[model samples]
Target: MALAYFVLGDADRGRANLRDYYLAIGPDHADQIARSAGTHTVALKETIESFAAIGADELILLPGLDDVNEVDRLAEAVL
Candidate 1:
């Protein structure tokens, strides 16, 4: 399992496997799975303040953020 692999300290491989699996199943299935799990799935295309206003407790920059200064500022503001 992906989570099992992650917990076993192979996060890169685990995440890759999970991503591949998700892609294979496609968005509709992924959305269904997310709904069944009681999660509100969303794309991270909005500003940090907007996300915060929508009750986001934490933010993960990932591919959307690259500026170190901005990242630090957001981290400080959020955390």
Candidate 2:
């Protein structure tokens, strides 16, 4: 959503946090995983926009160790 981008300006930072949570909790922590992935989704859109706003030629998304569906949704929203 545009509002997500409006709030979080940096995707990289958001992704980092997501990775940290996942690493700490591992795959079995569904509740915490959902929360982290939700946050990551918001950050992903912001990150793409942030890069676009800076005039990047190409966008590369690397959603390391996440809920694939959640990541797919975010990627669809962004690209």
Candidate 3:
């Protein structure tokens, strides 16, 4: 997404704001965050489908990307 922004002459930074957005809230909170993220993905997919059904013309997605292996797994899973 940031790369595409760069390609389109917009100087948006993705990786540059990581520390500002993420926090080390410890292991217990980690599991909750993980579970919430998973649930949110399901909700988002349904919402997007519903919007599409109602004639939504534009949808932009910044996927839930974490680890390097996860990215590769998702790429293989979908692409």
C-alpha lDDT score of every prediction, in listed order: 0.36, 0.48, 0.36
Separately for all candidates shown, the number of backbone clashes (residues 3 or more apart, or on different chains) is 0, 0, 0
TM-score of model number 1: 0.27
The segments of candidate 2 whose C-alpha lies over 4 angstroms from its true place after superposition are: 1-39, 66-79
lDDT of 1 by residue, 1-79 (tens): 0111111123244344445556667977644433222111122223444657777776544321223444344344335
- Compose the digit string of candidate 3's lDDT tens values, residues 1-79: 1100001111122222232234376555543433333223345455456657777767443334443444444334334
Residue lDDT tens for model 2, 1-79: 2222111224355545554655766755533443433344456666666767877857655443344554555556666
The superposed Cα distance between candidate 1 and the true structure at residue 19, in angstroms, equals: 8.6
- Candidate 3, clashing residue pairs? none
Best-to-worst order by TM-score is 2, 3, 1
- State in Å the error of residue 65, model 3: 3.9
- Taking all chains together, each candidate's TM-score versus the true structure is 0.27, 0.38, 0.28
